[model samples]
Target: MKVQVKSFFSVLSGGKPVVRTLDLQEGTTAEDAMKLMKVDFSDGAIILINGRPSNEKSVLSEGDFFVVMPPVSAA
Candidate 1:
């Protein structure tokens, strides 16, 4: 299965394009996906699956779109 990954922080891909494609198993969890992208989950990043907030344990399906970003802050 294929998933689309959109990252909001450079840490996901060393400041490269925020979008990338990942090929994973059907039952792959969000954490697994992040790992595939070489993203560090310990950063307290926020993840959203199909525009809905989700956790690392959440399982992802084929063609699902997920966004990863660092926690937002106000100045």
Candidate 2:
């Protein structure tokens, strides 16, 4: 399966917004995907799969668009 990953606010490996494509096997979990992308989960992040709220245990399907973003807070 092909998964598209987008990371915002330096939540991903490079510490910068990035768009990447990762090919994963069937039934890959969101958390596993995040780990593969090197995301920092300590601060708590939001997962959106196909524009809907998703959790780490959510299973992905082919051609899924997944986004990992830092938690939003108003100052």
Model 2 pairs in collision? none
Could you tell me how far off, in angstroms, the CA of residue 55 lies in candidate 2 after the best superposition? 0.6
Provide TM-scores for the models. 0.83, 0.84
Off-target runs (Cα >4 Å) in candidate 1 are 11-17
lDDT tens digits by residue: candidate 2, 1-75: 899999884643466688889999998998998898888777778999999999999999899999989887899
Candidate with top TM-score is 2
What's the lDDT for all of these models?
Answer: 0.85, 0.87
lDDT of 1 by residue, 1-75 (tens): 999998777754567547888889879999998888777778578999999999999999988999988876789
Q: Which residue runs of candidate 2 sit more than 4 Å off their true CA positions?
A: 9-16
Residue 45 error for model 2, in Å? 1.0
